[model samples]
Target: MPSITLIVNGASKSLEAWDPDMPLLYALRNDLGLHAAKFGCGLAQCGACTVLLDDMPVRSCSIRIADAAGRRVVTAEGLGSPEKPHAVQAAFIAEQAAQCGYCTNGMVMTAVALLRAVPRPSRDEAKQALAGNLCRCGSHERVLRAVQRAADSERA
Candidate 1:
């Protein structure tokens, strides 16, 4: 097994290599003990395993650890802290966007990237941006509001 170095949450993490094809989610969860990204569909269809790879949201469950090697990875935990949450995290909390919370991590991660790209995105834009993220709990409305709130909060 070889060691793969990854910049996770702005920190360099060395992963004890298992398989080159293994999903990045496994290493992040099992090795780093970061469980924010869930394995909802093994496939990349569900946004549950979404994480920021170099400032863009990618499906962790589908992305191989090798592909993520030497890349900048940011998980939900890396987004912010309890005392000073990221604008998106704070907005999600304020808007009560999470239902079961299973999809919250992905939602937050996606919104974080979106807000960075389009700080003042319209409601429809927000909806389209998060179209890939599936929140079976039917929290779409709140999620959109949260995105808007995050944009507002960030600009404040």
Candidate 2:
């Protein structure tokens, strides 16, 4: 157990000596009380625990907390506030993209990261970027639409 400092959601914070092998997902949820990032598969096969590390989506459940030290981590909570929503979050709501809502955060974060990389991703690019994220409720169509909607809204 070694103490490590990490930048999460634009804040510099420190974690006490915890198990180095523990995944970042647990640390964020249990220790940090930031439960927006879900834990779908601890093995990293599922993208349920996606978060942005330097604006790139990464599966939190796969990476150890120690490995995240000194990096900027942005969770869904970091994306937007309740009063002012991020374009992606606003678009998701506008498109009614969520069904059960379990995968929405990760999916939204993935889409946000994708749009950051390519403002106007082609349909295929959108699909490929979101491939790792799974929505068991079959919201892919709406999700894609939401991304496109966000892209449009961002341009406005």
lDDT of 2 at 29: 91
Writing each residue's lDDT as its tens digit, candidate 2 over 1-156 gives: 578888999998898845877888888898899988998978777788999988889999998988899999999999898899999999999999999999998899999999999999999999999998988899999999999999998888
> What TM-score fits each model?
0.98, 0.97
**How far is 62's C-alpha from truth in model 1 (Å)?**
0.8
Flag clash pairs in model 1.
none
Best by lDDT: 1
**Per-residue lDDT tens digits of candidate 1, residues 1-117?**
889999999999998886888899999999999999999999898899999999999999999999999999999999889998998999999999999999999999999999889
